[model samples]
Target: MKKIYLFLLALCWAGVSFGGDFVVIVSKDCPLASVSTTDLKRLYTGKLENIDGTSVSGTNLSMDNPAAVSFLSEIVGMATTDYKSFWLAQQIRGGSTAPAVKKSVSDMISYVKDNANAVGYVPKDAALDGVKAVEVK
Candidate 1:
């Protein structure tokens, strides 16, 4: 039992280490090609109205998904509850609400490609056909 538990722990740790890599992406027509963490935070919080001068708007994959949570904690540095609460406060303060979350990375990618101004992040291995990957600092 102890050996099995240890093996499971090792497996989980390996998965986390291997799984955290991610990529930020935007539509080809999106004005911005890359973004800083500051800009991303602003955009996610609705403080920045535009990316590369065009209006920015769109949703990301939801917190309930592991990849989404990993992206938030590893890339954006916010825990799920904190991230949602942050957006809620932003909405209450008249800042734009957090973008509506999609059900899957595939759905998010499709949504972003169609929306022009939409942007999102996904696991690094995910296919990026229509969207351009952005460098996130």
Candidate 2:
């Protein structure tokens, strides 16, 4: 029983240590102001056509980061492997291209803030103001 309890405790610790955080950001004046989980998923998945009544577009930072992966898995409800496969299939099908992927968090934040209809995700601790944080369910 002690050994089982030790193993469970270690597992919980590892989970907590490995988890990452991210924030979905939009311009302060984005048309459709707030976002629910459904809205966010729609926007990220290219299912939504617009933001604040205008055409919608979003960008994502490099997928190699933990925070980026966490956002996809936790907020978007997509496992890492499955998400990669989905993007790959989209590319093969020539579906509406994926979001313009940024190389760094700063670049993503800059692009989203400068483009009225653009949205993107960054680390939760990224220091930027005037960008609205969309709460994910």
Best by lDDT: 1
lDDT of 2 by residue, 18-132 (tens): 3458777788777655566666677777678675567778677788977778878865789767777877888898886777889998788778888878878888789866677
lDDT of each: 0.77, 0.74
- lDDT, residue 15, model 2: 46
Error (Å) of candidate 2 at residue 28 is: 2.4
lDDT of 1 at 103: 88
TM-score of each: 0.75, 0.75
- Model 1 ranges off by over 4 Å: 1-20, 92-95
Local accuracy of candidate 1 as per-residue lDDT tens digits, 54-97: 78774668778777787777645799899889888877888766
How many clashes does each candidate structure show, in the order listed? 0, 2
Error of 2 at 36 (Å): 1.4
Error of 2 at 74 (Å): 1.3
